[model samples]
Target: MARDYDSQLLESVAVRRRRMRDALLFGAQRARRSTDERLGKVFAGIAIAAVLCAGCVGWSFLQATLAQQKQQQQQQYGTPSAQPSSASSASTSR
Candidate 1:
């Protein structure tokens, strides 16, 4: 009878050990899933911010180029009226 009791006790202990291992594995899997979700969100936010920054830089460059073109056009076309007066004054003086 004593031998039978010892064998039953050993079986119960083995079952308990297996249950504990299963619980630990389940908890570890849940933790890994949560960590992966958090990392994915962080990377997505970084990608969005990078794209916005690039767009802003491109817009700034486009504005600067347009302003330069406008200035060149004004210099070329806006000075013609003044040149005729200057030439007439010089001819009168001569």
Candidate 2:
């Protein structure tokens, strides 16, 4: 009877140890999953920010190019004449 009791106790201890190990492994898996989710969110945010920055840079470049073209046009066209010269009018009247 004593030997049977000892065997039962040993079996119970082994079962408890297995339960503890499995619980620890499950907790570790949960933590790893949470970490991966957080990292995924962070990386997605970074990607979005990078894309926005790139778009802004492209927009700025386009605006600068347009401004440069406008300046060139103004330089090439010269200013418009506001009024006729007096010397030409006097010669035409005579």
Candidate 3:
């Protein structure tokens, strides 16, 4: 009877240790999953910010090009001359 009791006690202790190990493993896995989810959100935010910055840069370049074109057109056409023509000399000589 004592031998049987000793065997039962050993079995119970072994079972308890197994349960503790399983619980610890489950907790570790849960923590890892949570960490991964947080990391994913952080990476996504970074990607969005990068894209927005790129868009702003592109817009600035476009605006600068348009302004340059407008200035070039103005320079090409120029403003009307302010001086009068020199036709009076030819007409008087005729």
lDDT comparing candidate 3 with the true structure: 0.83
Clashes of 2: 0
What do the candidate models score in CA lDDT, each in turn? 0.91, 0.84, 0.83
Q: lDDT per residue, candidate 3, 2-22, as tens digits?
A: 999999999999999987886
For residues 1-94, write the lDDT of model 2, one tens digit per residue: 9999999999999999987876776565776766888999999999999999999999999999999999988876664332245666767999
Task: Record all residue pairs in model 1 with backbone atoms less than 3 Å apart, i.e. clashing.
Answer: none
Candidate 3 positional error at 14, Å? 34
lDDT of 2: 0.84
For residues 1-94, could you state the per-residue lDDT of candidate 1 as single tens digits? 9999999999999999987876776565776766888999999999999999999999999999999999999998889878989999999999
Q: What TM-score against the true fold does each predicted structure earn?
A: 0.54, 0.52, 0.53
Q: Which structure is stronger by lDDT: 1 or 3?
A: 1
Error of 1 at 92 (Å): 14
Of candidate 1, the 10-residue stretch with the lowest lDDT total is 22-31
Sorted by lDDT, highest first, which candidate order results?
A: 1, 2, 3
User: Residue 31 of model 2: what lDDT?
Assistant: 68
